[model samples]
Target: MRKLKKCLLVFISSLAIVLISYGVLFYFNFFQEFVTVKDNKVQWNNLPDDTFKSCYAPKLSFSSMPVTEISQTSINLLGNPVNNIKVLEKAQRYYIPLKSICTVLGFSLVKNNSEFILTKDNMNYILSNTDCIINGQSYSLRGNLIFYENKEYISISDIEYIFNLVADFDMNNKVISLLTPLSNSNKSENELTDGKVALIRLEDFSAESVLLSESGQMKFKIIGNYLNSQGIKYHIAWVPRYKSPSNNIDNDLLSNISIENVGFINTLDYLINHGGQVGLHGYSHQAGNNTSISGIELSHKYNSSEEATRSVLENAIDTASALNIPCTFFESPHYKATSKQKEVIKEYFQYLYEPNSILTFHKIQRENNNLFIPTPLGYVDNLDVSSIEKGLAHPTPGELASLFYHPYKELNFINFSKENFGVKVDYSSSSPLQQIVTSINRYNYRTIHVSDLKN
Candidate 1:
């Protein structure tokens, strides 16, 4: 009996030691495995020691200001100067009169006690002091609500934020230039006479790769010059950084748009000057060792957290802002992202260039304040025009026919012929892209900027 008791105690001690070791290993994540993609193969490895310690810091922050009085200011609504519109200056921030601005925007503003209700079409905004409800969604105003001289006032930034309009405030001149789709004073009514519109997007333009080469520069100029001559405004899906997946060296894989890439920047500037708008197209367009342009960046497979998503977006936005390029819209790499990731995207951009789904395309879908512009015609793959023509065949009045094409493909299509090897490619009538645009024009579809379709 004594020997059996001693043996039993030893066994209990051994079992406790094993159990405690297992718990400690799990607590330290020794058993946890993480995936590292290499050469298109998935490799599982133990979590790194500093994995938990590293976290992405937020790149954006907002500062609140107190209300203060200052000088009167004038306003410009789509280049037309407005007179007698009293603007309030609060803590160096300009606040436009809600009633007066609403009147200019053709929106009806009604006051009930301390609250003001602004309505236009399907949009509704209820402003009560520092709180605002837009389209049934509530938001706290960064600039405090002020009542000056028997009229309610909202900050210039707030006006842009709430109404989805672009507001540029010139502090020195005390002039606020407001641009909205609502204002059609600058547009000819006959442009979209049939109510058919089309948006052209050039995809995957980055600082690195062939786009910076001499041939690449010519191709870009060809496309830009052609679009300008056709009176067509388009969007460029710009990737701020290019990461080549096949390259193992860190320095070789990553390329940024900086002063070093002067030639590329100049080409971009030329495009922008000729009615080309830049749209954010992911930071690297790849996660880990996956491919760029083809790989998914903001899906559950990679950026699972909102913090990670915001960090990626901020990086892209900051990169473009550094080069003085404006990113008014966002297009996810390969148009792949989770719903949660898209929600975070909405916090930054007012427009998203994508479709409702793979099957549903042809209309602009609105989510809260962000607009999801669809690409109904898809892309021209290997110079195939069948898909594009099929999309152009059917048109509903007021419907949008949007599509994207890679400028690099133009090089292949235009230069593949031996006869045209050394000759300059004229994009006006020779290229398939020009043909697609001509088809869109033939269909009575007026080419318009993405912002013009906000209404």
Candidate 2:
């Protein structure tokens, strides 16, 4: 009986030891699955299989389209999975080549011959460095192969190279990538850092008028104060003077002699004297659609059908020269800009402020690499201030709000009779200007000025 008991004890002890060893080995070999969401799309781990599942199907816009299957492992990234897939498909269908996934995610890419790096989730990755220490791993340069009907094909070697270089990486520190388009590298270093831009601009001052009214000058003063407080750097643009349709309305006959009378030449002098900038605001606040003046005449004040567009731009340059402030930035009158207007402006102004955006007031121009900053001012007819108030209350990141008003609007409403401008009408509910001020304070918003732009 004693011998049998001893044998049983030994057997039990051996079994326990074997079990513990197996557990440790399994733990060491296992990899936990993780999900990544980016660009409004989701991706799940198929690290072992190279397969991805779509977390959500798109709202089919085309009839007879193939049904998309959803995979349980898929993730929802950037809150818009449907749009993300569409962008991916567009890239594939159009054969439009791109470098890294980071670009699609709206982040820049960087690399070094010896080390590969990227920044995502505010965390940085550096591969092929001693810190990563994956030199001994048998990493393979696998392409982004798309498999259809059991056959695979791929040509995106750059992406494959990045994956191979970092496949064995154990992220420990953060780093910024240095790779970028050649044109982007030419931008001032300060402009690229922090990825923030500041603009200073003026409205409606012209070559003919020199006075800074409370409405016009006050706006710039407030902007300067805000920018100084924020410790932000900025560029400035000058308002050029031109003849408006209402320009000929004699001051004596004009009932609303607002500063739309302010000429561009005078506007430039004031901006320069007041530590503001001088940029083109067209020769005149020209309006109208396809019949509008071309770029050359718009800039230089010359009427030429042979070079109507170029003439507008030349006139603008001439006007700028006349004001003693050369300008390459333009803001359309009253946000009334058409699509081709930019192509016209691009001939002279490197930056353009036009009225063609749904969300952003300022946008980086898509083609020219020149800043296509939209002046984010919304049109307020006083009745719709409530909706505007709500949006201001919950402003998005990088949101910019510009308030443009004809000083004459106030003058006309008040009927001060400063000048016999025209027949006047009136209403109550506080002026749109007053509502704008109240909303700004309520939202605790930062006000940017037209004159505070960076040249």
The C-alpha lDDT values of all candidates are 0.64, 0.36
Error of 2 at 437 (Å): 5.9
What is the per-residue lDDT of model 2 for residues 1-455, given as tens digits with 9 covering 90 to 100?
Answer: 99999999999999999888866754432323222223322222221121222222222221222222222211111221222221111111100122224555454446577555555665455544222212333222211223233322222222323322101000122111112211111112221122222233434544233223423332332332232333322334333333434436212101222222222122223233223444555554453321122222232233323356545455556544432353545775444444555555555554565534543343322333334556444545543456556656664443444434333243332321111211122323275544654565454443433322332
User: Which ranges of candidate 1 are over 4 A from the true structure?
Assistant: 1-194, 248-260, 357-360, 396-399, 413-425
Candidate 2 error regions (>4 Å):
1-202, 207-241, 244-268, 271-275, 287-306, 326-328, 334-338, 355-365, 380-388, 396-399, 409-455
lDDT of 1 by residue, 113-228 (tens): 87889999999999988778998988666455777777778866466557654443343464556655222112232333343556789999876667645556545755665676
Q: Report the number of backbone clashes for model 1.
A: 0
lDDT at 147 for candidate 1?
Answer: 74
Which predicted model would earn the best TM-score? 1
Candidate 1 TM-score to native: 0.54
Q: Which pairs clash in model 1?
A: none
